[model samples]
Every structure is written in structure tokens, then in C-alpha cells.
Target: MPHTYLVFVWHMHQPFYKDLATGEYQLPWTRMHALKDYYGMVEMLEEFPSIRQTFNLVPSMMVQIEEYAKGEALDPFLHRALKPAEELTDSEQEFILKYFFQANPSRMVYRYSRYGELYDAWRAAEGNVERLRRSLGAPGMRDLQVLSQLAWFDEIFQENDPEVRQLNEKGRDFTLEDQALMGRKQLEIIGHVLPAYRRMALKGQVELSVTPYYHPILPLLCDSNIALQSHPGVPLPRRFQYPGDARLQVHKALDYAEEKLGFRPQGMWPSEGSVSDEVLALAYDEGVRWMATDNGVLGATLSSLAGVRETYRPYVWKQDGREMRMIFRDHFLSDLIGFVYSRMDARAAAHHFLDRIRENARVLHNEGRDAMVPVILDGENAWEHFDHNGRPFLKELYRLISEDPGLSAVTVSEALERIPATELPRIHPGSWINANYDIWIGAEEDNQAWEYLLDARQTYDRVVNGPEGAALSEAGKAMALEELLIAEGSDWCWWYGPQHHSENRPEFDKLFRDHLAHVYRALELSPPEHLSRTILRIATPAYQQPPSGLISPRIDGEISSYFEWMGSGIYSPDHRQGAMHGRDNAVREVRYGSDGQKLFLRVDLEQQKPGALAGLEVRVIVKSVRHESELHATLLENGAKGTVVRSTRKRTLGAEVSCAYSQIFEMSVDLLSMGGRSAEMIQLQMSLWRDGLPLEAAPAQGWLELVPSEPSDWE
Candidate 1:
């Protein structure tokens, strides 16, 4: 049959957030996206069963979603948002103000009157939390908290669920009970995320593929030196030659997909469409029959582009008796949806996309050759910027495709089956970005990060290969290797360098260092001092600074001396979008220090309270590769000592600690438990809770790091 075979591989991924040493999830992105994107992306397909597409699910992302779906992940964002507004502390309030409005304002926030009003007030405040807090007040903040979560709920849920629809109707002045219900509803929606995809895959409406475990650049992992072939004279990081690691990742992807999807996926989308000759051979050896990357890689490999004839055909990369089918994505058509279509009317955008696709295939159809147009891009991130999460456009696109006879929306595997494969003699070693590894390796920060990783990998090899490794437990060996693999993922470096920008860059940098440090900590060895510091060679102007020296402060609510915190590291929360992530503020600043024996933390609120502000309380949390502890205290409760709950590598709680609050909030924590090295990265954060709802938090953009004791250090 002469048809334009459209293969859509929607790559869905987010940064790995789980701490290898502790089972805690560091960010709420995976869970948050599940509410808006994951379930609905597949469930929407049932309406147009005639159209089939491929979804490239990263195993790590699926793990987080499954954890969330089972009511297992402890999401701080969800807890704070659902908390009763009256009881929220200054920190919780500030956190809600900053993060809840993270959606595209016009598309998501401004859709509702209350959310729009709050967002406008937030913008007027110019990142001043106190001014914003004063303008919006608690009632306004509460309305925003509810609406933010409600706005992200899928259109299906919005239309079908009575309570959800009722809340949408109410739109303003929501109750405490309503906030709680929304929190519960989020998990309820996330629970359907996996099942929806599974059902659709089970019914053969879609095919599920996977990226390599941890989503590392497979080509770079096989040999970092390959990057030079694609981008000549680029400042190179030390060679990270490990084809075995690349193969293991591919093997794990197949094993995990079979376990989760009931069959080993034949198609693999090398992370970010990254590939090399070595990676291709590794994937094929691991039983991958086909893979898809960007047209750029195909363009670079084939060395010339002779129009749609070169791009719109399936290619067989066969060399040295190893062969695999490959599809080069239609970059122009894919970009129209991912970057351009969001601004246009939904029906218009969908029509324009189809028109371009049909026009592209006309010459092929005239020559009696079926056009294999592979459209590939991110499945999740682009929608939030679009009107109604791009549902109307997708529905319109799906309907038009269902009605069209000359075009057939098919999976990558289906498209390959219908087209004769052209032999691709070779491929350029590069990623989807500019046909090079520049995003992960070129800049000063990226190069420095890669060098650190190489050092960590060398240390792991030395330790595991030495005679001392004889005493290393099997668990310890596995942990060290696992942490190393996670550090090798492409996301950490994505935030590094000059190419991309994220407010969470510091957090990403710290996590990457932490992962490298854990490779040592997992073996009960001391990590190098370099890992204790920031890898961000450059950053925004200062208000936040690392610790200069050590200090010990009293736990009393009142400040006793001016010099008490003089030497401590400080985080004056900057709510400006680029400086830190939060929009509203209740917490003014946080001071971090360690007095050789115990870690010290002091939280300063925007305003001082006399004794008890009705229902205000504070929670101090510390997370490290060794242990995770959370402490709590009621506002100005003179001698009322606070309690602690801890999480360690065993993922169990077995700790009791104390803290005090009155004029100021102060606490001391034993950073490590169970007689282990504490060289891994430490994060400290304080949030205010009032009426059982979190109000504000210090260092709202990300957590403050508590350095391994010596000279005090915190970022």
C-alpha cells in the first residue's frame, strides 16, 4: 500500500531524583507530570484507535511514577499544597507562592480568575515575598494552592469528576477540606497513569519503547573521545571509555521493559537520540532490532542530504556483520509541534501540522515509494505551554489523521515493516543536540563536571579492583556501581555550561557531586574534599554564599550575640524567578553551620511572633547520603522540645532528636548515624507550618547543602 507512514516516538523523561543511599525522591516533577501528562497522553489514544504511535518511556521515570501511583513517594510539594492554609508556617506559604505558579500563566494560571489574580499580585511584588504575602494574604494564598493543583488535572478528570468539576466551578475561596481533597485527588489521578498506558499497550493501540536505564548518552558512555569526531577541536574531558556500561544499560532496559510491559521492547531510543557506531553495535548485541535518533545524526552519518529521499526512508545500519533498523526523525515537522504550534489556535495548529506532513510525502507518493516520516520529540514538557495542555490540538490532529486515507499514523516498527530499508554505511558519533556532545561536555562547568566523574569512576575501579575489595560486601559493590551509573546520566550536565538554564542548576550540580561522592561512601571510604564544594564555576550575583567558617549557636528562640552567626553560611531567599524558584515568602533567611560535632541550623522568619501565632509551627529537615532527618517545633513554645523522624539507607526510621524555638528557630543534628562516613552531600531546609498547612520555606529554590565538617560549607 502506498501510504505516508508517520512514526511518532514521544520521548518522556525527567531527571533522576531518588537518592541511592536513601529512598527519598528529591523533586516532585515526575509526580507532578504524571497528574497532567503521563496517563492522559496514552488514554487520549483510545479516541483515535486508528492511529498508532510509539512512546519512549525511560525506566527511571516509570519507577518514580509507579512509586507515586502506589501512594509510596513522599512528595513535599503535594504535602505543602494540601496543608490547611491557616496552619501553614511562613516557609510553607512562601513555598506555595513560588512553586504553585510554575505553570504557563496564560495557559494554565490565567484560565481561572482566582489563580490569575494571585499571579498578577505575585508579578507586581517583583519577587519580594513579604510584599507579595501582604498583598495576597492567607486566603489568597490558599485559593492559589488549590487552583494550581486543580489546573494541572487532566481534561478528562476536569470534565468527568463531579468534585473536580465542582471545584472548577467554585473557582475561588476554597475551604481547608477542599485543599485536602485536591491533594488526595492528585495521587488518585497518578494511580491511573501506568494503568492507562498498560491498557492501551495491552490492546495494541500503541507500542511502548524505552531509553537506556538512567538515560545516559550511550555514545558518550561508550567513549567520550567520540565527541571529538563530531565536534572537532572542542575542549575535551578525559576519555570515559566504557562500552560495557553502555551494554549493561541496554540489557537493563530490556529486562525492565519485559518486567513492566510484559515483553522486551525491540525498539530503543538512545537517550536524547544519541548514538555512535559502538553504541549501535552494543544495542544490537543486547537484542535491540531497531532504534531511532534525530535526522541530524542521519544527516551527519550519510554525509549529505538529497532532500526527503535521504531522510524519509528507513535505513539499515549494517557493518561488520551487525545490522539494525533505524529511523531518522523528521526534525522540521516535529519542531512545529514541540516549539511553534503552542501559540496558534488548536484546530489551526493541528491542520498546519498535517498539511506539512502531506506536502512532504507528495514527491515520495508520486515516485511510488511510501514515505516513512518519523516525528519524534519530548512527550511531556511541551504541553504545559500550550492551551489546555495541547489536548484540543491532539484531538484535532488525531481526528484528521483518522479521517485521512492517504496518510497512516503508525508506530516506528510498523513504518519499518512497510518500507524497504536503505543501507546506512556508518553513523556520526553524536547526540540529538547539534549532532554533538556539547551540551554535556564542552563548557567550563560541563568539562569540570565530567572530569570529576572520571576521577570518581577511577576511584571506584581502584577500590573495587584492589585487594581491599575482598572485604567489600556484595551490597556495597553494587551500591557503588549503581551510584556511578546514575551520575553518568545526561541531565546533570544539561543544567551545566552555557547551553541551558534552570533555576535548579545548583541542586542539579550538588546531586551530581553527591552521586559521585556516594560511590566512595557506599564502600565506607572517605570522599575527596573537592566533592564537598560546588561544581558551578559561575553563578548569579551573591546574596547566597557558602560557609566561611564553623560556629556553634544556642538552640534558644532568641539570638544571644551578633557574632554567633557571623561565620556561618547564609541563604537569603531570593524569590526572583532566576535567583530562586519560590514566588511568595514567609521565611526571610536561613543560616547554616557545623560545630565539629553536630550540624547547626537557624531559621529566621519574615516577622517575629510573640508566643504562638494561632497554629504556626516549623519543621527542619536534613538529608544526606547517610541519613535523612526531619525535626519540628511549635512557634514560640518556650521549652517544648521538638521531635525527629529519620530515614537511612535501610529506608527505615530509628532516631529521636530535639530542637527548640521561641524568638528564633534553632536546632542541632547529628549529621550521620550508624557509624558511617558522612562525606556525602548534605541538604538542610526549614519550612513553616500553620493550621496543618505549610506556609513558607527558606532557600525556597532548592535545599541548602551542609558540607562535611572542617571549614564550614553550605550552598
Candidate 2:
């Protein structure tokens, strides 16, 4: 039996982070991601010549790239984007010299013609930047052309350039501006890199698609209330009717794709395969004929709509009883490649992927329906894990698929045109994250966060709905909208994971409160006197301080402070762990608590702790379950800092401190290399240590809730 396997990969993303005022990106990961994967994948297709795939470029990411394309001095922007390393390793410095245009022959030749050396020499000299600055005078679109030309030269070192080393350095500190600039550069590079794809796409060799701006979870974006309830403490990054925002995102993204690629994309890939009826309607409003979600969403939808067996293939999603040609990705296979195949040899993995599709096609043939397999996944990050940098695996997969007569590949848009509008299913409101929504919800800490958000949401509604809110001016409305957008960020809730609260809970609370405060002010509402001071207290630094009963250890960087009360009106260290994670170079900052039952420990991570492990392990005897016990860990590192509870047990308070350690390698050293369930368990334990000691122990005046895990044997 012959079957056409349509492998469609919809790459969806947003700027890693956005500036509050300018809406500009603050992190380059998004743009760098496009350059490394989105553009790379498109360009790679030139080799297959016949292979086709779908991509969804978010408008927000494109906007940043566009800014790069319009820059006056590419070099300065590039330098700003790629923050200079504070202390580069010898190897890193060598790579910089080896790959940079000034030192590397390949890069110099690729970027410059005969003048490459002159440009390189100018770049090498401190005065040269000033000279080049004078020569350029002002930044503009033409400067982008010059930069674009020079970027081509950088291809020689694009993969091995020193910038990546800094980006990957988890423990290093980066200034906020540097982080923002890096993000801009990353996007600019992507804009520059995409021309390679635009060339192919222009030649009708590949197909492109667009997604909603910022790549937010569409269903959540459409309705903040849903997110608030499902994931209580999570902050919404933007404010607006989600449906309207989603429509805007899609329209803008599609428009940008058209402008950049010289053609409108035929389909759309909702961010993270996130979807729902509201999202579907927004897609319709945006003129997007097709969208894709994880196969799990489709199956769940089919079970609700038809109560029949569902298959992983392209289908038409209908709204108001109308067909909406939509596609479902074989998430299992897709994840296998994106998550697992990278770990396998290219030949074996590629063959296995093809075999899986072949098996699925055979099954579809029996069912008498043409099967379209969307083998979509991240184009970058996944590649680094592959041997030979994913070249072998990708090349092999392309070779086999293109040459195999039995198999055929088509872009998602083209495939949709071939399929007829059929019976539709109700897609459950969800995303490709955890099925239960625990990733974004269910943590107690998150619940607390949500309580704050709910207040903000309600207040905003009142302001807009009430006389005060109605009094807002156009400028006021815009400012309020900006505040609302920041409030909707998903990072706040996401920081708390797998349990009671995320470490970034405090930030989430602050952001939500601040936004509400702004809305309140815009509406000219005088808080009912009492609430004014309370709101101010929550919104101001008055309510924030270091934890109690902990001593500061001598370290070089910054430290984080965390404290939480679970109804008792007493600060307990255990309850506050989830409020801190990913903070670097921490020593005890301050500790404040009264009763022996309650304690606060403020830790700081300044200089690197000598022989610091990524995490630590502590043990306590498991006493009777009657005793209430909890364990939390904090990291004081770089500029960002926080704390998290590694484990909690009643009567079994003994657990390890689960700090986001400085040495991820040391954390992985114990377990990742081996197999077997018990071994894996042991490895997992090693990776998630609760407590014992810091990588380096220091003594200061802070409180410690150090306790035994079990009760006395005599008792």
C-alpha cells in the first residue's frame, strides 16, 4: 500500500523575555534559536530539494529581528547583544580569536571579500570601533545590509563562537541590559539568517507558517480566568482579552512572515500546541485556515465528540459546525526525536523514525485514510545533543525520506488543501504540558500567587467597569495595558514546579500587585483608606526582607531572602523553600522568626563556593508521621536569586536541601550515566538532594531549622 507521510514541524516561540515599556525583547535566546534552528532547518531543506515542512514564526520574535535588520551599526549592536565575557576561559578566548573575523581565516573570508582583513583589523582595535562608528554615522536599513554581509562571514564560527559559551554558563552573572541586548542580537541574527530560507522559500522549495505573537499558550491567553483557576499563582504576562491578543498575534505574525518570506504562510502552529475553542475561533478570525496541536489533544477531543477511536493525522477542526482544517502531531514520535533520538546515532535513529512512520502508515492504510505525520520538534537545542551536531541524523533522515519512493513529504498548508472538511471533534482546553496541568497549577505556593493575581484581575475589571476605570484616558489606557501584559507572564507560576510553590513566587506576587496598583491609580480610585496602606505595604519593599534565624556565609555574589506562613502567622523556613530557586552564589542574608517552631534563613551566593555541588543530600531518620516536617533550599547566584523546598514530610522532616547548585555536571555525575529503575531512582535522588551542607560552609548570624527526620527510638 502506498501512503503520503506529511511531516510538518511547526516551530512556535516568543522573545525569551520582553521589555516592560518598549515591548522589545530582553533575551537573545529566541532569535538565536531561530538562527540556529528555524533558519537552519529551512536552509537544510535545500539539500533534500523535495522535502517540505511548516514553521510558525511568532510576530514578537520577528519584530525584534526586524529591528536588527534596521540597525545603523551592526557591529555595535552585535557586540551589545553578545555581552563580552567577564572572564573567558583560555579555550573560549582561543575560540573567539579562532572564529572571530579578525583572527579566523574562514570567518574573515565568509564575511568580507578582500576588505575582510581591513574590517577585521578595525574591529580588533579599540579606536577602530570609533572609526567605524564615524564611518557609519547613523544606523539604518543600509547598515543592516552591511552587517548582513559581515554575518555571512561569521558562519565559519557561528556554531563555535565564544558567545555560546557565555550563554550556556549557568552560574555566570549577566547584567539586565546585557541580557536584553543579547536577546536583541539573537533575534537580529535570526533575521539575517532567515534570508537563506527566504531564498529557498522564494524558489517554492519550502513552506512557512506563522503563530501568535509572543508564543503564549493560546488557550490561557484567551482567558486569564481559566489560567488563574487552573494555575493559581501563575502571572499572566500581558493584559487584554486573550481572544483579541491571540488574533493580533496571529495576524501580525502572518503579516511578518509574508513580508520576510515574500509569501503568506498557508497555516499556523499554535504556541506549544496549546489550544481550545476560544483559540480556534481566534485562528479563524486571523484567517488561519489550519493549526496544529499535540495528538493527545485530538484524541481527547475525539473521545468527547464522537466516542470513537482516533488517529494521529491531519483533520479539519470545525468551529460553529464549520470545518477548520487542523493537524495533530504524533507527539510520541516527535518527542522521541526532539528528546531522545538526539541521544542516538543518526543512522539508527533516522531509520527507526522512518520505520515508526511506516508502521503508522500501514495502520492508516487498513483504516482507509491517508496518513499525514507531522514529525515536528525543536530545530535547535535538540541538535546539540546529537553526535556530529545533528548533521548525521538530519542528513540521514532527509536522505532516506527524499530518496524513498514509497514515502512523500508535503508542507502542512498543501496537505490541508487536499483534505476535505469532515466531522469535527471538541478539543479539550489544554496544552502539551502535563496532562493534569500540574506544571502550571496545583502547587500551594502557586495558589497563594493566584490569590494575589485574582485580586489584581478583579481590581482591574472594577476600574475598567467602574466609574473610576471608565475615566481612564487613551494614554492611561495604554499604560494600563502595558502593566496588564507584564502581569500575565507565565514565568511566575512556572517557577513553582512539582509541588507547593515555585521559587519565583515573590516576584510573581510583586508584579501582580504592582500592576493592580497601577490600575488603581489610573482609575483615580482612593482605596478605602485601610486598604491603601495595606496595598502599599504589599506593593512596596516594606513587606519584603531577609529570612530569620539564619547566618550569612561569606561568598562573593548576591543572596536571596524568602519567608512564608501557612495560616499560622509565623514564618517557617520549610514553607518558604519553593520561593527560591536558580539564585546563585548565596550566603545567609538575614533570618527573622520568633517561636522555636518557626524560623527564617536568608542565604546569599556571592563568590563561587569552593567545591560546590550542584545540589546537596541530607538524611533524617523517618520517625512517626505525626511530626510535621519540611525541607527547603535556596541559591544565591548571579543577579537572579530564589529558594525552593526540595521535600516535605510530616513527622519525617529529614530531607536533603534541593538547591539549584553551581555544578550541574557534579549533580549529573552520580546518576545520569547508568540505568535500571533502582539505579535511576538513586540517580534521581542524587540529582534532587534536600540538604547536608553548602558547597562551602560559612558562619554568620542567621537561623537554621536543622532538625532530625525521625523521633527518638525510646519514644
Candidate 3:
């Protein structure tokens, strides 16, 4: 029977924990989980040897994994996870023994009885861990190794970690030794598993794909102003040309993939499924035969494809008189596995997915048309949440597709190979994000943040394009350009959501500033004060303390509710002790006083290990109840003095510092001064920073009430 459906998914992503400066990896759990999830998925492909899938191994992530596979930086992090086993009590020993007895494939008959004796000796000592340790000391390294291997099975998926997430932000550095270790791991993975992927693609078992370098929101990188149009409250940074920069990003992806992967990818998954006509034209000019975006983009850009009103079908997109095949992803189906399905049983989820494809195929056949359903999502993230480490679901899904007569699977490249390019219409400029740039640029908090970014961008542009521009060597110029490009990614700005406006805002500011600073330094500019002045002008006030007593977190009154995982450590409330890699966590206390117009907020952040102190930042934002006329103050400070007190900065203007004791930092605000009389609500954020940058920060908010000011209320 002719194939009625084509299942194509391309997993694209970079580990946010990979530190750019020293190239060190902070989150070992992400790597450990990703390895199991991805490897398990690949192994499942064995059941349906003929089943095809596309895997886009980001160059950066590929590098990090290779380093771990070769005993580089990650070996130590792995060592740390294994260290806890040394202190296990009697009950813990029993737990380990029972768990691994069912796990290890190479258990010696005598070793089983040996483990039982150790278990018995430890249990006989009750809860005395020293005795247990002494008893296990004989087995020592061997036992620890077993425990280390077993830790991988703990089944807790690592999500956004605040510590690791902060490292991804600007101005943070990983030590050199750490970087070397991570680099070695990347090279190792390249030598080891990457080859398996290459061989699979070469053998037609899978297809390989690639994304733009640094995985930026291409449209925003082209023109920061796109945000101003969509987000009314958000201000545009210095104006940037669109089509020109877009071209650079597209060409860069093609060149990198062709050079590293041995063949030009037939199709590209624009970073984050971000797309527009300008983006598509750039892709086609650079030889991208096809690309895919979220179905929502197609629904907006073209009302219908191939006479089909819906965007779920694969169709050709025309841009600038050139045409390329485009596939609109069924985000609901794809993300079901990435985010939602993790809560379900692997078998049930797999069955449900297979059934959907079957139903789609049957319907298409009944209607007399071919059904090309694009199932696209992140490869590593989805499996981390799945049961059996996503093994059963993946295997079942691939097997059902490969063996079932009703459906067939093909890699994106294979499908694109079957279609020929034709002339296309003029494409528009936009992204899958909010149908415009509002998510990145629209918001009072976002606009204020960009005002500072614009100042910094202009400062850097002047230095680079000035007389110093002529004297720089070719390499220096190239480095400056690349640094600016990397710094311009849109992820930092879009992190503003709900009341969390200042969360990732500072990092956005610092990166834009740092790149500009690099340009000034390279050009022999003097007195860093010029840059500092610009930063402070746009800097918001810091909070007096971190949030405390976070026995439970509620969002919109729902216990432990989490909506977005942009920058704050991917704190999945269900997992205790696991940090959100590349995200931060702060607990907050909100109390309203005197008819509701007066507000008090306390933010508390638990410290990381000693000597990791960078500093803390606090921003208090007051908005009119109607969500208009916003005013804010930002304060930055170093050290953790657990007390609520105010201080002034002699060297800086408008600097009023407040701090609190007991791990709970408080900031008090009266709405009357900042349009509070006419406004109905208020928002405050306190973010922790390392080296003058913001980490995971959540907003605390409340409605305003009319009240008389106490005699104590004056600046």
C-alpha cells in the first residue's frame, strides 16, 4: 500500500548549562538524563529498523556531550552525585541493594550474597551510618561505582536549574579547569556517539538537521524594533536592519552544517521554529531546500496551503520568487510528548500517539489526499519527564510506525528529496512567537530594559565604527562581530511574563553592555565610567531580601503552578533538591496594608555553596491599575547580610539599598507616588546575581487599596 502518512520529527537544542567563557558545564544531571533519554530513543528505533527520524545535534551541545563521554569536565560532577552513597545509612544500603539487584546485568553469584552481608551488618547497627560506612569500606570503590550507576536510575528528570541557568547569563564565568573538562567531554562524545548518528544518516536509518548558530530568534536579531510594534509598553533598542542580519544567520547555519556534517541539510528547523518570509528567503538563498515552523506560523502567513485551509499539512512556501517545501508542525501533538505526556504511562502515551497517526492517515485516505504530519519537538527535554526514561514509549511508537502497514516514517530530508522547489510569493517578516515581536518587546518593564540596551548598543557601535575601526586587525573585527551576534539572541528579553518582569531583564542588559564594553576595550577607550554611567541610568533598584518560608508555592492561587521556564532555573516543583539548570529560584512574601494601597514584599534566595557570592538585585515596579504609567527602581549590592535596612551609595545616583534578616528580604512601596492613586495593582521582583547579573527571579504582586500614608512615609 502507498504510504498515507509521513512522520517526521527534528530535535533541536543546546544545553543552557554550557558556559560560553570557560566552556565548563555546570549541570551534570541534564547530561546524564539526556544521554539515557536520547540513547534509549535511538535504541528503540531498532524495533522498527526501517523507521526514520531526524535529529539536530546542536554543535555546542554535541561538543559538551563529547566531553562527558571522554571523562572531561562532567566526570567530577558525576563523582559528586556518587559521593552521597558513601554516607548511606542502613536503610539506604538496603534500598540500594534491592534496587540494583534487579538492575545490574553482570552480578556475580557470590557478590549477591556479599551485598546481603553488607546490608545485614549495616541494618544490625540501626541508623549508625559510621558503622555502615566502615562495613562497606572493604568493597569501597566497587560499591560506589555500583551506586553511581544506580543513581542514573533515580528517575528524577532535571529541569530548569537556577544556578546553571545563571551561568548562561552574561558576565558569569566557569573556571578554566572546568572548561577543559567539559571540552574534553565534548570531543569524547564526538568521537563516540556522534559517529553513530552520522552512520545512521549515511545508512538511511535517520536524517540529520541543523539550526542557526547560537540558536537565536532570527527575526529579532535582524531588527530589535519588531518588538516595539508588538509590545506597546516595551521600548525598542537602537534600530537594527532586518534582512541583512537575517541573511548572515541563515548562511552561517548552512556553512556550519555542510562543513561539519559532511552534507548540506536538505531542510532546516529555524531556531525555535521561528520563521517569516525574510527568514525563509535567507534560508533558500543559502541552499536550505526546506524548513519547518510551528503550524501557527503557517496559519498566519498563508491562509491555506495546497488549497487546504489548515496548516497541519506539508506544503511549499514561496519567498522572493523562490520556493521551498515547508512543513507545519502539529505543536499540540509534538509538545504532548515534550511537556504533557511525561505525566502519563509510557505505553499509554505511545499508544495514544500511534492511534492519532492512524486516525489522521485514515481520515486523509477517506478524503483522497496524502497526510504528511510533522511531529517536531525537543529530543532530550521530552524524554527526561517520561517513565522508564522514555524508553518504552519511544520504542513502542517507532515500532508501531515501522511495522504497521497503515503508516510510514521518513526523515525530513527524505521527504524534502521527493519534492522539487518552485517559485514562491514574497514572504513576510515575523516569528512563531506571538505572531509578532510582542513577547520579546511589548511590556513597560521590557521597554525600560531596552532603553538601557539601546544606550549600550549605540556606545559599542560608535567605538567599533569610529577611527579605531580602521586600525583593528581582521581577526579583531571578526571576533567583535561574532560576539555582538551571540549577544543579540532574543531569549533574554522574552523571559518577562506575568509579574516576572525583571527576572531575566538584567542579563539582557548586561550582555548588550558587555559586548559594547568589549568593543571599547579593543579600541583603547578610557575610563570605564562612561559605560557604568549608562548602566546605572537604566538600572532598577535591588530588593532588601530574598523570599523565605516557601513551604509551598502557588501561582494564580493554584498550588505549585509553573507556566514558563525561560530563564529561572527550570524549577519543576515536583523535584526536590534538583536545581533548574540555567535558571534561578527565589521565594517571596507579599503583604498588603491599610485599605490595600500599601504593599510590602520580602524575597529570599538560599545561598549556593560558599565563595559563590556575586550579589543581589531588587526592582520595585509600580503600574497604574489599568496597566499604564509604570515607574521602577533597581538596587544592586554584594554580600548576604540577613537584615532589613536601608543604605545609600555615595558614588551612584538614586541609590537606596534595603536588606532584611532571616533569609527573607523585604521591600516596601506606597502606590500613591507612582500613579498608585489611579492604579489598582503593584509588582515587585528580587533577583540574585553573580558578578553583576540577574538569576531566576519571580514577581510578587497584589491589588492596591486607598489608604492614608503614615507620618513615617517620606523619601
Top candidate, metric TM-score: 1
Error of 2 at 330 (Å): 0.7
User: For model 1, how does the per-residue alpha-carbon lDDT over 1-715 read when each residue is reduced to its tens digit?
Assistant: 5688888889989988887665666667888788888888888897888989899999989988888878888767777788778788876777777678888888898999888998888888887988888777778888988998898888888888998898999999998888888888888998888777778888887899999999998888888888889999998888889888888888988898899888899999999889888889889988999998888887888787636877889999998999999998888888999999999999999989988888888878889888988889999999998988999999999999899998889988888888999998788887777889899887888888889888888888898999879999999999999998899899998998888886567668767877887888877675554454566764433378777777877777678898888778888765444322232445567888876556787776655454444246667667776566666666544644566544555533334344566666677766545233445566777766543333455544456775656543332
Off by over 4 Å in 1: 540-715
TM-score of each: 0.78, 0.56, 0.59
Q: Is candidate 1 or candidate 3 better by lDDT?
A: 1
lDDT of 2 by residue, 295-353 (tens): 66665665542111244455776667555677777778878987888667779999998
Candidate 2 accuracy as lDDT = 0.47
Error of 3 at 569 (Å): 33
In model 2, which runs have C-alpha deviations exceeding 4 angstroms?
22-26, 68-191, 221-266, 304-309, 319-321, 366-369, 419-422, 434-436, 445-454, 457-473, 486-492, 499-715
**Residue 463 of candidate 3: its Cα lDDT?**
61
Q: Number of clashes in every candidate structure?
A: 21, 74, 65
What's the TM for model 1?
Answer: 0.78
What is candidate 3's local distance difference test score? 0.49
TM-score-wise, the better of 1 and 3 is 1
lDDT, candidate 2, residue 292? 75
